[model samples]
Target chain A: MLTKRIIPCLDIKNGRTVKGVNFLDLRDAGDPVELAAIYAAEGADELVFLDISATEEKRKTLAELVRKVAEKVDIPFTVGGGIAAVEDVEILLHNGADKVSVNSSAVKRPELIDELSGRFGSQCVVVAVDARQVDGQWRVHLVGGKVPTEIPLYEWVTEAERRGAGEILFTSMDHDGTKNGFANEALAHISGLVNIPVIASGGAGEMQHFADAFLKGKADAALAASVFHFKEMEINPLKAFLRAQDIAVRL
Target chain B: MKNIVIIDYGAGNIQSVKFAVERLGHQAVLTDDAATIKKADKVIFPGVGAAGSAMSKLRATGLDRLIPELEQPVLGICLGMQLMCRHSEEGNTSGLGIFDADVLRFPDSVKVPQIGWNRISGLKSDLFDGIRDGEFMYLVHSYYVPDCPEAVAYTSYGIAYASALKKDNFYGVQFHPEKSSTAGAAVLKNFLETVS
Candidate 1:
């Protein structure tokens, strides 16, 4: 049986983790590599390093961080944020990051999906879509879900799958950081529409929220940032809780 | 010291596999050079990506022909496992024919690419030495090889399929042992130390 995955998403800025990670036991919390190693040791199914670096030099620093993490951590990981072109993805993958996620750059150039998948194979290309409800309709948002676009969430995911996306990381801007829950209805809808795996991002508050994401949302994987970072929930116990819920989890 | 060479034909993430070996206190080199691969004591054929292009790359570099003929213990991972089979439903690819089986895609009833951790059981190979049945391993692929005589292990999503296969000098696993954490690291260690 394939078990549901629990991924810890770390927002990296200038090669250091940006979000407030409250691991009291750690010597240095800002070091993304150290945090990643801790997460891997804690049995995180996978890790996502979202590089929010703006300058090109910082991007190089991100790549170096990825190499270090890959060298130390045995588990798989994906790198994202500001991946606009093939070279950006190539450097990351070459540095030992397993997969590369693309968001606004993919929206800016839909063909970018086709090109990355064609070149690196869809398995290594993760298409991340940020969407929120706009006047009763889910509209794709840009600039980290601040700016909205006319593209429907369902329509874009279907197109992304067609464009050879191996997986879809859907973030509901409305549900994100709400501590309410995931966009289950939208996630189920996307799952029904596309053949690829769907990763539910945002709106993760508690263990039950994760269970809801898997049982109700039908998400292949669930990604959370602050909860895992701030030590609100531990991964192993969460997986144990999910397993007790009869949801298959890697224990 | 063993000369471990990871066959790098530019298809998948070979670096992780090399790092796994390094983690086990062994140094392995990544190369497409035929002479180097032939001289290695243990050969790792790891790939991740489409089978057709991977096979094409293997053929282009003449590694396809060189692989089956090598006398050393050869282990293939994921798409590398698929390419070792006779054929794949993906890309209508013809494989290296090392394993007397056919690669297949999972049914639509389940997810397309069976991502995340899955259990492998019915362990019958030294490749699975010290690894318990029902131990979880990370898997990511759309295509798989059905149960066959060469199957050393199996994983079930909707149906039981060959997750790991072995035939004499060649071994293949559908899961990414390098990324499977401790159990994965142990599996790789077994391959390096046990499968001779």
Candidate 2:
């Protein structure tokens, strides 16, 4: 049986981990490579590095950082934030990233997903959707959730799957920082509409939230940032909890 | 101290395999040059993407014929492993026939690509030397090789299947050791140190 994945997301800016990770034994808390190694050692199923400010110069730095992280960590890693073209995906994959996530750029040109999935396998492509509930309907948001689009979340996710997106990372804007819990209602709706694996993102407050995402939302994975960055929850104990709850998690 | 060569047939992430090899204190090189591959201490056939395109690339580079004739130990990863089989239902493609096994797509009941960590047991080869039964390893594939005589380890999804195979100098694993953390690194280390 395939186990549910626990992913730790690191925000990168100017080649340094922007979020202050609270691992005591880490020699350099700001170093993405060191933080990634720590997470791997803690049995994180995967690691995601998001380049918050992905300028051309910063992208080069991210690539170098990816190479450094891949050398030391044996688990799968994903790179995202400003991937706009197949060439960009190529560069990251060549630098040892197992998968690449695309957001605003993929929405700007939906064909970008087709081109990427065609060049690389669909498994290499991850389409991240940021959605917020507006007027009782889930609407897709762009540009870090400041702008909204007419396309409904359901319609956009269905089209993304049709376009060969191997997986969907759905983030609920309303619940993002609230940490109340995951938007299980919305996650279940999206999971029902698509066959690909769905990764529930945002609003992960406690370990039970992860379980709810898997049991109720039917999510294949759960991604969290601040909780892991601040050391509010460690991965091993979380996996143990999930295991005790009859949830299959990689320990 | 070994010169490990990762065969480059223009498919999938060879960089991770190269990095993993180097991380183990061995020099790793990626090349399609026949001479360079022949001279290496060990060879890794790493691949991703459709088997049809991968096999075509191998034939185009003439590595398909050379691979079977090589006497050194060779390890195939994921799609690389499938292409070494007798046949693949993917695109009805013919394989290198190194292992008398056939790759078939998973039934509609389960997820198409069984992605994430799954435990492998019934280990039989040095590839899993120190690895315990039910140790988690990362896997991502739409098709799988059913139980065969060459199987070295087994994993179950909808049915029991050959997760790893060994036939003399040729070895193949459906899982990605490069992405499987400590247990995966141990598998690769075993291949590098024990297979020869």
Candidate 3:
């Protein structure tokens, strides 16, 4: 059977990975190329580098960083953030990102999604939806969870699928930093409705949370931050915990 | 100087493969001309994308029939490897038949595209030299060949499938060694060194 993937997401700013990274190695841990090599050796299934900067200079730096990472690390990696157009997706992909994730851009101009998926097969396109429960309704968040799109979460997910997204990366902003666990109620509901793989994001405080996410929530993969970044948790042990729980993990 | 010819049928990812081989200090020429391919010491058939389209392009250039007759070491990557088989369920297309295997689609229980890095174990030939049994290599394929005598390595995705195969002068891998990092590059390096 196909093994469920374990991904570590690194937020990049000005060609450097932000948060949870120590500046000890090679001046700082923000160097995307060096950080990527380390993660690939640690047996990370996939890596996601989100360019947090919105400026053109920062985007150019991110593209250069992506090229460096692609040269050093030979694994599947995805790039996101500031990806608003098909040209943006093309540039990143050409630079070596195996897949490109679109969030706010897809919501603002859905035609971009259709155009990208058409140009580079659907498998190359990923739709990342950052959601938060607002007054009993799940609402989508844009601009790195700062701006509200007013679009319902489920409706947006369904629309993304119809628009040719290969996978959905759903992040719960409310449960993001808490680590209480994943938003199982929301994920389980989405998994039942979608045919493509659903990757559950946010609220991964412990290894067991991953188990629960796979078993109860039916997530194809889990993306974590603080736990893996701070060394509070390791991928092998987390995968061991999940495997013990009878979940399929690439060991 | 060992000259490695990489077929560029305009249907696959050629730059990465050429770069990977060149990084190891070997010459990898990406070309569609028969003269250059025939003059090379070894040949690499690298591809990505659909099977039918790849075969169509190969046939259009007459390289499909020309490839199997070369008495040199040939390594086929991903879709190129699948095209070497007798037939493929992908696009209901026929193949080079260099190896006696049929490529079948993964059952729905497993995902369509078996994407990501998976461990390849049970080494049986020189192709796996210096490579540990459980070491992981990168893979991204939807159709796989069932067990055959030529299989040098096996990987489990939706089911146990052939990860590496060697038949006489012909060798094939379902994974992309060019994009598989150091280990994958090592595998290609090994093939380059040993394919006399």
Candidate 4:
């Protein structure tokens, strides 16, 4: 049986892990490589490094950071946030990121998904959709959720799948940072609509939320940032909890 | 101090495999040079992409013929494993004929990619030495090779399929051991130490 994945997302800014993860055991929480090793040791199924850095120089630094993290950790990790082209994806994958996620750039030019999947294979392409409920309809948002589009969440994911996206990382903007829970209603709707695996992102507050994302939302994997970054929830115990709840997880 | 060659035919995500080999303290090289691959102590045939195109690239570089004839230990990952079979449903492509098996698509009842950690059991090869049954390994694929005489490990999704296959010096895994954490590293290490 395939196990539900528990992912810890590290927000990277200027080639360093943001949000100041202050674990006593960690020698340096700001180091992306160090934090990634800690997460991998703690039983994280996967790690996601969202390179929030915008400068070209810092992006190069992110590549170096990715190489370092890849050397230290054996688990699959994804790199997202500033990926805008096939070359960007190549740089990260060459530096040892298992997959690369594209968000705003993929929406700005949907054909980019086709070109990427054609060149790198769909398994390496992850189309990340940031959506929020607007006027009782889930609308896709762009530029970090400040801008809205006419494309509905379901329609966009369907198109992404059609364009050869291997997986869909769906983030609910309204629930992001709130830690209330995942947008299970929306997740179930999208998961039913697509054939590829859907990763539920944003709005993970407690361990049960992860279980809910799997059971109620039908998500293949659940990704969280703040709860893990602040050490509010550790992955090992969380997997144990999920196992007790009868959820199949990699322990 | 063994030389490990990761056969490269423009496939994506070979870097992780190379990194994993280096992490095991071996000198790993990514090359399409047939001579280099033949000279290596062990060869890691890593690939990601469509089977037809990947096969085309292999043929164009003359690697298709060289790969099967090599006497050294050869481990194929993902699509590389599928290409070792006799045929693949993907792209209606014929394979390298290293393994007497056929690759088929997972039924529509299950998700197309089966993308996540899955357990491998019924280990029958030294490739899984020191690894327990039901240990999770990262898998990402739509097509699979069914159980055959070469199957050394089995995993069930919609049906029981060969998660690891072995025949003499040729071995293949449907999962990405490079991305499977410690257990995955152990599998690679076993291949390096015991397969020879």
Cand. 1 Cα-lDDT: 0.89
Score residue A126 of candidate 2 by CA lDDT. Answer: 89
- Per-residue lDDT tens digits for candidate 1, residues B1-196, read 9899999999778889998999999999999999999999999999988888888999998988999898999999999888999998888989999999998888989877778899999999998889989999999888888999999999998999999999999999999999999999999998887778
Candidate 2 residue A214 C-alpha distance from true site, Å: 0.8
Model 2 per-residue lDDT tens digits across residues B1-196:
7888999888988889988888788878889999999998899999988898898999999998999988899999999999999999987999999999999999978766777899999999988888999899999888999999999999999899999999999999999998898889899999898888
Predict model 4's lDDT versus the native.
0.89
- Give the Å error, residue A201, model 1: 1.1
Q: What TM-score number comes out for model 4? A: 0.96
Clashing pairs in 3: none
- Residue range A1-251, candidate 3, lDDT tens digits: 45788899887777776753221122224567777777777767788987777676976787788777776676678888878777787778767677889988888998877887776656778899998999989999987677877899999988888887878999998888787999999999888777678889989888889988888888888898767777888888788888787887766
DockQ-based CAPRI category assigned to the predicted complex of candidate 2:
medium
Could you give the interface RMSD of candidate 3 in angstroms?
2.7
Instruction: Give the TM-score comparing model 2 with the true structure, all chains together.
Output: 0.96
lDDT of 4 by residue, B139-169 (tens): 9898999989999999999899999999999
The per-residue C-alpha lDDT of model 4 at residue B100 equals 96
Q: Give the poorly placed runs of model 3, Cα more than 4 Å off.
A: A20-29, B11-29, B59-62, B119-123, B130-135, B148-150, B179-183
lDDT tens digits, residue span A148-244, model 4: 9989999999999999999999999888877899999999988999988999998898998999999999999999987887789999999999999
| Candidate 1 interface RMS | 0.9
Candidates in order have lDDT scores of 0.89, 0.89, 0.81, 0.89
Off by over 4 Å in 4: A19-29
On the 0 to 100 scale, the lDDT of residue B73 in model 2 is: 92
Say which candidate scores most in lDDT: 1
Instruction: Please give, for residues B1-196, the per-residue lDDT of candidate 3 as tens digits.
Output: 8888989887544656766787788877789999999998889998776788788999999998999898888999988899999999977999999999999987877654666667888888777789888777777776899989889999987578888888888899988887776788888988899756
On a 0 to 100 scale, what is the lDDT of residue B186 in model 3?
A: 85
